[model samples]
Target: MVLAWNGADPSEVGDGSNYELGVWYRAEVDITITHLRIWTGPGEINVTNRRGRIWSSGGGALAVITLPDNPGDGWTLHALTAPLQIDSGTTFLPSYSTGGNYGALPNALNANVPSADGNLVALSAANSPTGFNGTFNTDPETFPNSGFGAPFYGVDFQYTLGHGDATPPRIVDTSAIADGLQVTAAAVVEDDEDLTGLTLRIDWGDGTDATTVTYPTLQASHTYATSGIYPLLFRATDSSGETANRADFVQVFGADASSNRLNTKAMQQALASHAMVLGNFKTVSLHEPRVRPAEPLHVALWWSTITPIDASGLAVTSARVEWLLRMYTPGEQEPQDEMDAIIGDATDRLIGSLARDFDLDDHVVDGLVRMIDIRGAHGARLNAVAGWARWSDGMSRVVTVTIPVIVNDVWQEGAA
Candidate 1:
């Protein structure tokens, strides 16, 4: 089933106003509408006149149904006798009559509502400043021409793809096995329809072209010359072009793990086994101990909260957590370069909170990786200070950890 609006129910309900209320929407691809739905308030009565309707851009009624009385406080679906086929990019309105109390969320339709299957309820002001979430003040059902405050009136529809495929391919599981410098990746994929033409593509995330394979042969291998952590992306596209994607990570260890050098796993294990708790969070750093000058120094830092750390007071809805990694010369007081990121802020692109990303129990470790350039440096004496800070005051809420950075002396052989 496909729906134009997938958000939670509206928080507010209005009085029993006899108005025709609905939203205007379009689909990315051709779709067939099979049912219309409305939100009925609890203990709502007099539902005999409750009607569901679909109107074209020209105010022509395409489909109409008399909704059955439902006193429940949730969505109620009403099937249409004949499925209505809507062309792509065609704008239409799906509405219901508010014979009794109705549910609405003001300013909810300010942005477009897009379903995973490609149907979209455009912004309330897309057509005109007063056009999308329409309302007509009349007892009889009619095409609503005026809108108010971009409110969502709890009207939606169920649809299916015109191509007859109602479901997309699913990537059930993914795995990556690293053997030395080579990593083998595989996935288990299934589709509701036939999998005759299913295609699987793997992006090694090392700036290489993705590897594609057909169904029943969903495995691929890649070899890297350097040791680092690589993210593996798997995407499966079915015959109908419906796709599903999954991601995993592969850590490659270099052939040499000498005293001066440590592998990715070794560094991670060393940091994890140690009791390194900074304030309310624990951190682990993984990187090669030695790197060549001008080469990208890949570092992955894992952190989780040891306790409930709230940067903002209880009065604020949310707070920000900042992560900083600074590189400095040994015995120096200043950093040569640094990287910082802020989370839990309104401007954050990442979706989640400190509690969501890092469980207080610290069972799950969330990590961030960065590549720092060490150009013009030839000595084996460098330091990296990593820690977290409070975004409000720019102060370190967590104790910082200093790791050694050793640049190999290969670049100094021909330099004077």
Candidate 2:
């Protein structure tokens, strides 16, 4: 999926301009690029020494391939020596140099191009500081950032759905319970590829041997000798050996104590569903739908991968989770009050000890809670946005969810 435009012939063809012409674009998801393509003009046939290149937004060459000397007068594709992985939400440039006429369509990239696999948006002056269509010296192959008008220079790339099996399996919709001396855990596990050899491991966190099971069977039970609070761990491994881990806190009540005090039944029912998904990697659920002006809001965020994202061997170093809260008058566009927090580095000062690390050691089906001081009038609405960002790249991937909250000094039944 990432293509500059549809496979239609351009309406205009430029005379042999010995310059590199291409499009600057961004992908909505991670993709593995295997080939580069260029729309050749009728006169471009038999042209020799045609070269194509993929460049980073910062002007670094990523991959270069030579087109066939006798490419047909249509879309010409050249496979790279190896597949190149492109991170989601990052910009890149794909260009080709030919001392022959090139096909083009004016103002074609003013908006996103249509693709079946993934979203590909052309960068323009309106949407991007780097602009969209561009040209540069053909011989030296410098980054193409000079053109304008959002023209389609016919440069494109072919990519697969994701970074292959580079991504680990996702563990979502998890539920755990510890009643009396027996503990039970379950999760919905999935991977980018087949789960033929996937395995789920459960550690009761009570100094006992962990329980292991295969895919399609995620539920595990363990019996403890004493009644207490125990940490439960769940780990899933795909065929590629990539693994994802999750944790939960289980409480076992003594004989005289009532298990109903913990409300395990209601918590388990809630864990079966999620309120929303953030950045396609984290699932979120609201724990407290209604809160007072000065009270705190609680939400549970379950990540598909380990916290402090391990984007090693990629473009960035580290990543952090962030959240933003906005309160507004019933139907107003402007916010009356707002609060935000970042849950990685710089967390200590951002929210003043409210930034809690993801409970990888113990997930009590709790929320990442933060106090919100609503200054808006009564009957205000609340919306929450959360996402993750790369520390080095500064590119954020976010998602927004609207959760109803009633902020008032007087408690009223059915008042929204």
Candidate 3:
């Protein structure tokens, strides 16, 4: 993804009158490259190994004009018939020249790029039409007092890791533990390229339906209902259907009713149910109500419990949990994704009104309030109870509520 030349400069030109101009780029380690961007016209453009062996050519029929014709002014992308693996430190010389007199398009020129390898540009003696056949650094050469001010031409390149790599993803780590009611198994998956759309399948040895998932995230977790020593298997498959797997990867032990703790399975099920309910709402445009693809929502749940005490502990408060919900609009890529974040404040009019005696997770409650306030048709079904106390010492139980929300991407789509 690196560009060898500056793209922001608003100037571009072909090799004026000169027979040829080229840059010799030294490759670092072995690289598999697919294409290079160059400004070309009626003449030929070519790549040669350190020994000057032709590897790729844009034109044919070696008249003076050997490369293909470029019809436009900007840099044109020329695909190398296939990926070529070049060894490290190998000098790759890419050049463009005038085969039929400097008419139409010459090679692209980045006039004053001081960082260019000045030694790589070779010129021809006057009237020497052959490429790179003449003098070096003598034709209109600008050698500045500062070593960094010499001019260089422009070139860009692209490479891919999937070129010749056939190895499958490897499982780096695995762990399992009994959390409340279920056994949670986690695995860390990795690949040479760590690319997207790789399929991961988790086989919970307890005969549960194996889960198949695809995402770029390396960490994955699954919970089993009942527990014994359940062996787990993780299999990863690339787009090429080449799969690498780890068998009997991990063993998880489940918990029983006697394990005194908040029910993890119940908590997971509750959160999953809430996620499904929120995902069911269709996006409604503020101008007109219409259906569109639903955006992805992330739900996080955290909780803490307190031990209720009394001579007769019949009215014991069990636990308190918080749910945080987020929505990612489609076409909103990371790093460049624009987000409108609304921090939930105790004094914010819209969310502050919802603060009753019930102690809601302020963060999650604020996100829910913001989700509903966006410009669109929004609705929610919520139930809650204020702090209810039933004790001689008067310790109130914190009430929790369920709130489902759908984030409409109508604005994002319009912006796109």
Which candidate leads the pack in lDDT?
1
lDDT of each: 0.56, 0.54, 0.36
Worst 10 residues of 3 by lDDT: 140-149
Give the better candidate number (1 or 2) by lDDT.
1
Q: In angstroms, what RMSD does candidate 2 have relative to the true structure?
A: 21.1
Given candidate 1, what's the lDDT at residue 36?
Answer: 86
lDDT of 2 at 374: 28
Arranged by TM-score, best first: 1, 2, 3
The residue-by-residue lDDT of candidate 1 on 171-201, one tens digit each, is: 8888888888899999998765446557899
Off by over 4 Å in 3: 1-30, 33-56, 59-168, 190-199, 213-216, 238-242, 248-416
TM-scores of all predicted structures: 0.39, 0.38, 0.28
Runs of candidate 1 exceeding 4 Å displacement = 128-132, 163-416
**Cα displacement (Å) at residue 126, model 1:** 3.5
Q: Report the candidate with higher TM-score, 1 versus 3.
A: 1
Clashes of each: 0, 0, 3
Mind giving the per-residue lDDT tens digits that candidate 3 earns over 1-416?
22334323323444434334334344545555545545543443332211111222221211112234433445644445555565654444444443222322122222322123221222212212222221122221111011111223333444443237445676666555555435555557766643445677877755778878775544455676653334456677754345766543232334543222334333333333333222221221112112222342222233322222221223322332333222223323243312222111111322233333122122222121123212212323333322322334332222233332232111211232
